[model samples]
Target: MHGLIGQLRTTPGGRGEVVAALVEGARDMPGNLVYLVAEDAEDPTSIWVTEVWETEAAHRASLDLPSVRAAIARARPHLTGMGTRVVTRPVASLGA
Candidate 1:
């Protein structure tokens, strides 16, 4: 599995827009096993995305998409965006 974990800190008052775009993008990734998105309970402006894809190619494909691009552009203005980390692992280990 190929996964991406992203943590975003939105500018105050930009949370709603960022959340909406993330919701749309999360629903849009194809063949994704998990696209879990959440806002921090303690800090509503913080967003986290846990995404798992079938392959690295699949995840790469998502990066080229218009919707994904749009989301990125929209979020860029609002996010503190420390950084995102990607991980690749065999499917079997998921059960452990």
Candidate 2:
């Protein structure tokens, strides 16, 4: 499986909006095993997203989806900075 972990820092008071868009975009996505959005405990404006997919291609294809495009557009303004983006090969997960 293909997986990704992204860390984002949103504008002041914008994390909620960003998280909302990310979740909405991923709703009912095919090949998506996990899509988790979490807030940073130490930083109020920071958010983290963890995604697992059946294949790298499926994850890439998700970028072209209409819902994803819309969500990206919606969240763009609130995105102030990005921290880390790491790719991984997922072997297994309890809930995924």
Candidate 3:
């Protein structure tokens, strides 16, 4: 499985808007096993997104989806910077 973990930094007080856009776009995605968005406990303007997909290609294809594109457009204005990012090969899952 393909997995991605990343941190997104938003403009002041813009985290909620970014999170909303991401969650809305993630509602229906083929090959998506997990799409988790979480607020950073230590930073008000930081958000973390963790994604799991059946394959690396599946994850790449999602970028072209209309919803995904729209979400990117919506969130772009609020994004200030990108933080830590990691790509991983998932070997197992528990509840997913």
Candidate 4:
């Protein structure tokens, strides 16, 4: 399985909007196993997203999805910076 973990930095008080956009856009993505969005515990303006997919291609393809495009449009205005992003090979999962 393929996985990605990334952090996004939002404008002040913009985390909630960005999180909502991300969550909404992630629905029904083909080959997506997990798409988790979280608020950073120590940063009011930071959001974390963890995603697991069947393949790297599946993950890449999601970027062209209409919902994802819309979400990017919505979130872009609020984004201030991007933080750590790691590509991973998922070998085990709790429920899998």
Where in model 2 is the C-alpha error above 4 Å? none
State candidate 1's TM-score: 0.78
lDDT of 3 by residue, 1-96 (tens): 999999999999899999999999998889999999999999999999999999999999999999999999999999999999999888888884
Error of 2 at 58 (Å): 0.1
Compose the digit string of candidate 2's lDDT tens values, residues 6-96.
9999999999999999989889778889999999999998999999999999999999999999999999999998999999998878842
Model 4 Cα lDDT, one tens digit per residue, 46-79: 9999999999999999999999999999999999
Better of 1 and 2 by lDDT: 2
Cα lDDT, all candidates: 0.77, 0.92, 0.96, 0.95
Candidate with more favorable, higher TM-score: 1 or 3: 3
TM per candidate comes to: 0.78, 0.95, 0.96, 0.97
Clashing pairs in 2: none
lDDT of 1 by residue, 12-90 (tens): 9888888888777656677678877788788877877777889888888888888888888877888876545657474
Query: What's model 2's overall lDDT?
Result: 0.92
Listed per candidate, the RMSD to the true structure in angstroms reads 3.0, 1.1, 0.8, 1.1
**2 versus 4: better lDDT goes to:** 4
Residue pairs with clashing backbones, model 4: none
Q: What TM-score does structure 3 among the candidates reach? A: 0.96
Q: What C-alpha lDDT, on a 0 to 100 scale, does residue 41 get in candidate 3?
A: 99
